[model samples]
Every structure is written in structure tokens, then in C-alpha cells.
Target: MGHEYAFDWLDQMVHELDPQRTEPERLDNYQSIAIVEKAASEKKRLILLFKQFVFREQKTRQIRNSVNHYLSAAVSLMKIANNNLNQIPTKANNFRLALESVFSCLSEVSAFIVNRYRSHVDRDISLNLVNITPDAHDLRTLGNRDAMKSNLKLSKLVTEAFSDIFSDHRGGEITMRKLDYWVSVSHAVTYPNGLLEMTTPFEQLELIMIERNFNSPLFVKYLVSKFSEGIANSEDPSSRVQALTFLQKTFNQIPVMKDIIFNNQFEDLTLTINSWFIQEINFHSERSGTVFSDLGEQTQKASKKYERKTSDKVLCNLTVDQLSIFFKAADLSNIISARSLSAIFQSVAPYLSTPHRTDISHSSLRVKSYSVEERDKSLLIDIMTRLTEQIRDL
Candidate 1:
């Protein structure tokens, strides 16, 4: 269904260019985009080359509505996915199906990138280098008119994109190299026999999840789920933590949830932790019967895990009066209880904001929302571990 939608969008984009009336320059660029995309369906290296071309062409930018259609479509689909990962049909493979359009549309966008050597990107290093650095007398050459501009842009684009993976240094400071070096290396690697362009599973997925097209929340969850393979396969705790850190950084990049998540210090995180905290709290409270009537007899009896679902539903859907009572009665001698209180506070604080948090915090319980990913995960792990120990009997 998703791929079909993307194809319809692509057809619409192609039809937008009136074939009979379209000028040679516009028509050629459009056709080139389609061809490049068709090739890119097989090679990831084409994407890197496409980016280089885009930066170069935009130097004296062409700002056409028809030209922007591909970019617009890619970005729109991304937003839909990044906005909410949970809502996407995960179990039924609906989310993965939708993502097919993403790769296809992005490939088309790659084709739109205008550069003198757009046609020969798939050629060998020697041939591409000759094409990139053309002779003035050669009819096939770029004529050197826009050579400097294109070369400079390529230098800038490659350096920026691969700063982490590869870089050139001069006198301890990073600087541009000869133009041929950039074009040569870029072309060399993608050639069938050249340096093997290795990519991680994450990197491969990233290629498909272009920010413009797959920005929805469903995509965010998919990313997390994908990373879980890396996390689970690793026996090392550090590797697992790195996986989570990677997830956190990537999640932060999604536009749909960025502001709200970064703004309130991930108040939603509190809700998540609170669900567990609340569940454990109820389980212990009902079993011990310490905080309820008939407490002595219940505490003496064999404690079964709390089975009453009604109170939990009410706990989740707390009214202002009920929330205030929960906060008032909470005894937070342990960290789990404290975090649980914070989680409960977070859930209902929106409906009954100021006085609740202020009143709850007035007691010795200090509930902090760690803005940093490392700290939040560390603290949550510590609290949850102690929480499990504390609820051993329950």
C-alpha cells in the first residue's frame, strides 16, 4: 500500500513536467534523476555520489516547484512515521511495507542532482576522473566554465558528510585537498573492484529512512526495534548501553517528537517508568495490606500478587482528587517508591499541575528528570533494580 502510494506520487511528479512543452534542460534533468534512482536501487554508494552532485548543482540553485516534488514527498512520509511509532502496524508488517516508498522516492530525488558528470557516476575510477577533470580541448570535457565551482562544492560536501569516518589534515587543522583527489576517491570506492563500501545494518536502514520522507513516530519505533537485535546479540553490557545511547540520539533527531520530548525533559518517560512503579506499588501495597484497612490479617496471610484490575485502571485514569490522595498517602522510604511517586505525579500533573508537583516534592522524595540520555538510563536502571529487590516477596 505504501509503495503504491509512493509510485503514484512519482508518476504525478513525472506528469507534472509537460513532456511536449518541457524545455531540454528541465526534461534532461528529470530523466537523469529517474535513471540515477533506478541504478541506486542496487548500490548505496550512489547515494553518497548523489549528495555530492546535489550540493554542486545548488551553487547557482534551481528553485522549481516540479524539482522539489521528490524532496517534498520523501520528507512528508518521514514525518508521518516519526510522529508516532506505536500507531504504525508493526505486528502485521504494515510499517515495513510503507517504508518501501521511502527508498524509491529518495532514489528519484538523487537523480535530480545536476552535475556535469551525472551520466557517468557508475563508471570506473579512471573514466570518472577523466570525466570529472575534463580537458578544455576535448569535446566530452566540462569546458572548465563551472569546473572550479563544482569541484569546490564536491570537496566541501564530502568533507562535511564523512568528517567522522574520513578526513584530510594539514598542520593539525582540517582543510580542503586538490579537487581531483575528492572526485577520484569518491569515484574509486563505488567502482565494482574499488574499495568495498561496507555499511552497518543501522547505516543501511538509515539510507532508506530519509528524514524528509520517514519522520513519523512509527519509524522511530521501527528504528528502536531494529537496534534491539544488536543489543540482544551482544553479551557485553557496555555494548547494550551503546545500543540504547544510539537509539536515544536517533530518537532525538525525529522532528515530530523532538520539541515535546526535549522540552519537558521527557515527561513521557516519567509516564513509562511510572506505569511499572505504579504496578509494583499496587502489588506490594495490596499484598502487605500495610496502607489499607484489615492490614494485620492480610499481612499475616500468604500474599498473592494483587489481581484487582479495576483499581489499576482507576490509577492510570486518575482524577485530581484521587491523585492528591495517592500523593498524600505515598510513603517513599525507598528509591523505587520515590520514582513511582514521580511517575504517578507525571501522569496526573498535566491535569492538576502546579500544586501537585509542589506538594508531592515538599516531602523528602526528590523526583528528578535527567535531561541527558546516559544519566536517565543509568538512574532508571538503578531504581528498577532496587525496585525488583524491594518487591521480592510480592
Candidate 2:
């Protein structure tokens, strides 16, 4: 019966998309469920990509409406089951049981989707149906009332079965990434065009729960405790440094959740530590130096001078094409060490936003198939020009 309703709901949705399409006599139960689940997954990907904002908005509204329809149907059926208890006890009980099962499936499926894609979906969309399917709060209220007056066992079962969907009550249940299979299982939460990416599981989990509008008190507490331990272990500077770096990154990445993640306890502990003073001092020093010193002026002069010269023009801004030409000349002359070239690029690639696969190799660049972005190109030009100049002076 649950599958039948799911199939009908899916069919109705399809008809909305194509009015002329004919409805089949019946859809396979698993196939119907799979279709809806697949739709949810695809919608999530589209929302993340934001390719067609208007279309996605319409689809989200349609999904919310479908969820409401299911909730309303379930509630009405449950009420009927309760009303006919005395006249048709067995049938009513069976109907009620079936309704509870459907609700369980819905809640679990919602939770699973939310958990699986928590890192990818935007928080606002996650709040809707991307990550979280809104709980049947009204239905839960009705069940509570029924339990109080007459049917305690079935009502309890109904509530207990889907209790995971209730807000704020299940903090300890948030999924944690298991470390044993971290290499194979861990994924960098990435979005369209690489606009956003999070590599760490902790940050991924933090964003996931934040988007769900869930506090995850247990996770927060655990993080806070770890942070405090890091700060207090003054014995090991490395541990303290790692802790401070983590805190700084948390502030940078998820500024909105900083207060929640680093609550009053963290605030007090951080106050006791004096590393924040160094940060403030360094920031002021850097700003003052940039404004007062001739270093910036000299650097600009050198860049302009290098840009103007015909022979030196390539050194000012290097593109892949320029790099290819330079590499060919350098490789032929054996000016730069061929063996060290890949290693040097690998080290500075992230800083320059250079993209590459598993590793950089000399052969890959021989045909000029490898490409480097403009930003990285200029930096690489600077490095290579300086190295060649140093070698010449030597």
C-alpha cells in the first residue's frame, strides 16, 4: 500500500511534467521508490551547481508540495484508523500499522539523504528537502494524543520508529567519519566549478549540520573539548599550534558557526592564552610596513621594467604557451635542472592555484599538453627568472 501511494504520487508528478504522457497500470515498487530517490539526488546536484536557478526553485517547490501531500494523506488515513477502532478493530489496526511503516520509511530515507549529501547541499536548500525532509510534526502530535487517550502501544511504536526526524533531540546521533577506511571513504566535499571545497571531515560535518539548521551539540562539545585540550597542552608547542591553526580556519571557513562551535568555554580558554596578541601585532606590523616601506615601490618598478623589455617580456607574465616556449629553450640549454623542475612546481602549485593530476612529470610538458593558469604563470615566471639569474651570477 505504501509503495502503491508512492507510485501514484510519482505518476502524478510525471504527468505534471508531460501532460500527454499515458500512465501505466502499475509501476514496480522498488522502481517507483528508486525513481523518487534518484530525482532527489539529481535535484541536489542541480541545486549545488545552480545552473538553472529558476528551474531549481520550481522543482524545490514541487518537492515541498509532494512532501506535504504525503504527510496530509498519512495523517488523514491515521485519523480514519483511530475513528474506526471499535467498529473494525483488526482492519483499523492493520491500516494504522501500515501508515506507521510508511512514516518510518520516509523519515529514514530523509535522514539518509541528509547524511549522505550533507556536505554538498547548501544550508538553506538542505533545510528544505535537499538534505532534510521536514518531519511530520503534526502527525507526531496526533499520535501523542491518541497514545494518551486509548492506544498506547501502537502510538508509542509510531513515535519511536521515526524519532530520528525530531529536531534537537538526537544530537549524539550525528554520523562521524570512520578513520579505518579514511583513504578510500573520505571525499573532499566539492561544488560546481570548484567554487567551494572542504577536504577535512570535521569541517565537512560542521557545514553539513549547520546547513541542516541542526546544532549537533555532541559534535560541537567534542570539538570544543579537543580545542581546549590543544590550547592547554602548553607542553607541546606543535599540539598548541595545530589547535590554534584549526581555530583560525574554523573562523575563516564558517564564520557564521564560530560562536556555536567555539562557545563561552572556548572563549574563556582562548582569553587565557596569549597567541591572539601575536596575531594582532603581526597584522599591524604588516600593514605599517606595506604603507611606509620602499620595498613595494621597488617591486612595482622591477615588474614594470621587466614587462617593457622585449627579451624579458615573457618573464613578467607566463602563460602555458609562454611556459612551453621557455621550457623548450631551457630544456635544450639545460639551464634548469630537469629532475628538480617537477618537484619545484609541485611544491608551489597550491599557492599559485596551479592544477595538476597525481604528479607533474617532464614528459607531460614535452608536448605542451599540460596547462597552468595565468595567476600561477606569473609566479612561475618570477621563480624561474630569479633562478636563472642566480645561476648566471654564480
Candidate 3:
């Protein structure tokens, strides 16, 4: 009976495997298959999750690599732009284009990283990523666009980066010199037209000459040449006056440049004006005489001990010749009289010469009565001669 039971059990297990089983047996078999299907579905879901994680890791690596590559390219472009000082315009434009490309690529990569893993990346890293975006925009709009704030910010960045490279001690001087050249060239290129426009590179060079203690003979020669060019190109009288004033103030700072201003042969600038005055005196004799006579009267009055107090009280008291001297001096003199020359002479003459005296014998008088043009010529010659003497004493 035991052997018969064992055979029946074995036969029953085999019967359950058949598709055409009884209803109760079929229900049990179907339940088992459903469980197996559920387990397989769970396994497939887990495999998908693992694949997504791997893809994300790979993408992150790619983005980081791209960011590094673009950063390097941007830095390299800036260096290349700086190195080619003479060709700054072309090189700077190329650098700007290259920087734009880097920025675009970086933006795309950063956006990808931000969108793909917004929760995973650090906030600071994301912010830094965004910072480069505006920098790109600024570089793009530098010359083509009229944006002052953006250009200034860009300039600050460039200057700061340069300062870092230049402020070091080891091989830093070379780097600093390179940066200085680059700054000069870049200023020449960009600032010539924009809101940040500056005077010629020589103006800044003059400042550098003062600041850097660059007391070389060649440097002074270069500075003088630049000053001369500035004076030549300056169309505005005020600007020319300002240039000469600055030149005068900085004159003592440059020992080597003293000859350029003081030496008679090289700089017969005063003679040029005097020759002009001689011609003008002959042309406007009556007008010149009246103006000079008024000046003489004023001088004579101002000199009198009794009239000094009254003369001091008079305001708007310039002699007609005093005013005419400036306006007509240019017409009388063929060369343009530097307004500075007129102003300085007027200021210095009172202390240098004795006040005119009517009681003095005409023969003893060093002052000669002459036409307006002649008086102007005499005044210019006397003033320049005194100045030349002073320069010699210095």
C-alpha cells in the first residue's frame, strides 16, 4: 500500500505540469506563473535604474571635461591677445571670438549639467558657471555695442587678471611688461572710439614716465616726441594749453628733456612768434598804437605811489591792448600764439620789470613807445628772453 501511494504522488506531480489539467490544478499553476512574471518585471525595472545611473555618471564626466577644455581655451586666447601687442585689434577680436565660442560651449555644457542633475550639483558651482555667461556677452558687445557698464566690467576683469600675473616676483617683470604693452595697445584700439575713449597713448605714457622712475635717456626722448605729437594734433586751444601746462609741470621731473625746452637752436618756438609780431605791427599800426598807449597809461598809473590805491580799486581794468594783444596777436603774428605764452608772461611781468614812469627821461627809458604790433613784439621778445634766462639758471 505504501509503494502504491508513492507512485500516485509522483503521477499527480507530473499531471499538474500538463496544460489540460483539472480546474483546481490549473488555478494553482496559473497563480505560480503570475508570481514568476512579477519577479521578472521587478528584475527588469532594477536593470533600467542601474543603466540610467551609469549614463548620468558618464554625462557628468563629459561635461566636466568640456568645461575644463573651454576654460583653458579662453585663458589661452587672452594670453595670445596680450602677447601680440602691436596687433592688438586683430588679436583682441580673435580672442573675443574664441572666448565667445568657449562661453557658448560652456553654457551648453553647464545647462546640460544643471538640467540633468539639478539636485546633485553644488549651488556655488552653478553660480560660477553662470558668471562666465555674462562675461561672454560683454566680450561680444565690446566694440560693436555701446554698453559702458559692460565694457568697464570687462576691462576690470582683464586688468585684475593681468595684475595677478604681473604682481608676482619670479618672471613677473616680464609678464608685467607684456601686460603694460598690451594695455597700451588695447587702449589705443578700443578706447579710441568708445565711451571709455582716452587721450593718445602718449598721455598715459607720460604718466608712466613719472610713476615708474624710468629715467632713461631713450624714454625721455620718447616722451618728448609723444608730447610734441600731442601738441601738434590737439586742435582745441584749451587742450593745447593744458598739454603744455602739464609738460611744464612735469618738466623738472625729466632732467634729460630740459634741452628740448631750453635749447635755443632746437626749439626756436619763441622766435617763431616774435617774427610773426614784427609783421603784425607793420600791418595794424594805428590800432596797435592805441592799444599799446592804453597799456602804457595803465602801467604808468599803477606805478604812481599816489595812484596805486585808485588803480587797485579798478576792476575789469585790462587795457584795450591787453585784450587786443591776445585776439589780434595771432593775426599780427603769422604763427598761433600759445595762449599759455600770453598768460604766463602777463603773470610774471609785474614782478620782473619796474612799473613805467612818465617822469623818466625818454633816453633813459628802456621801454620804447611803439605801435601795438611793435609793443607786442617787444613784450614777447622780452618775456621769452627772461624765460630763457631762467631756464639757463635752472
lDDT string, candidate 2, 142-248, tens digits? 53232222434433433342244334333222221111111111121112113222534233333433322222344345445545654675455444544555554
Candidate 2 Cα deviation (angstroms), residue 224 = 1.2
Ranking by TM-score: 2, 1, 3
Instruction: Tell me the tens digit of each residue's lDDT in model 1 across 19-81.
Output: 233332333444555544543453354445445544544432232222233334544433443
* CA displacement after TM-score superposition, residue 121 of candidate 2 (Å): 18
lDDT rank order: 2, 3, 1
Candidate 3, which ten residues in sequence have the lowest lDDT sum? 257-266
> Which candidate model has the greater lDDT, 1 or 2?
2
Give lDDT per model, in order: 0.34, 0.36, 0.35
Q: Which window of 10 residues has the lowest lDDT sum in candidate 1?
A: 122-131
- Which residue pairs collide, candidate 2? none
Give me the displacement of residue 238 in model 1, in angstroms.
Answer: 35
Candidate 1 residue 299 C-alpha distance from true site, Å: 19
Superposed Cα RMSD, model 3: 34.4
